[model samples]
Target: MRKEQRVKKNKEFQEIFKKGTSFANRQFVLYSLKQEEAQPFRIGISVSKKIGNAVCRNRIKRYIRQAFLELREDVQDNHDYLIIARKPAADMDFHEVKSSITHVLKRGKVLKKTSYGKNDRKK
Candidate 1:
């Protein structure tokens, strides 16, 4: 993810927390705030000490970033997103993290609906 696409400031995170709408699953909480201007989406991630040590928290953060990278095209482009990882996330691998984030995005109605071709079908 590019620096421009990340929400790094404490102020920004607080604004999103206060004004954004949130969606959550068992493993993660997602906060989304739509921007008035046209720009690429930005994301902020928070992993608490309660989840694990630095290594474990970093791993979960990495997984979440990678998941967002892959889902970038499908996600709305003019919003700021904040993801907070729960305890169950520490034990999950990359794929689990991706699917869980996808689930949250879907519930939040932030992911675009893509029409799949016949050959594009899974299986």
Candidate 2:
């Protein structure tokens, strides 16, 4: 995850929380807000003490960053996304976390669909 692709400032997070649309599942909650100008995607991950200790929280953040990196192309650019991990997320593995975030992004309509539908089977 690049620094430029991260939502690091406190004010930035607050603005997104105030203006963003949110979606959630058992594992995580996603808040997305479109930016005014064209820019790269900025992502933030939140895992509080209620979820775990420092090591556990950091692990979850890493998983989220990796998941976001994988899904970067599908994700809408010029937006800020905040991912808040739930208690169940602490027990989940990388794949689970990836699925969880993708689900939320789909529900939030932030993940762009391919023009060629899934039914177009490869020869």
Which window of 10 residues has the lowest lDDT sum in candidate 2?
Answer: 114-123
Among the numbered candidates, top TM-score falls to 1
Q: Write the per-residue lDDT of candidate 1 for residues 30-108, one digit (tens) a residue.
A: 9999999999999999999999999999999999999999888889999999999999999999988988888888899
TM-score of 1: 0.93
Off by over 4 Å in 2: 115-123
Residue 20 displacement (Å), model 1? 0.2
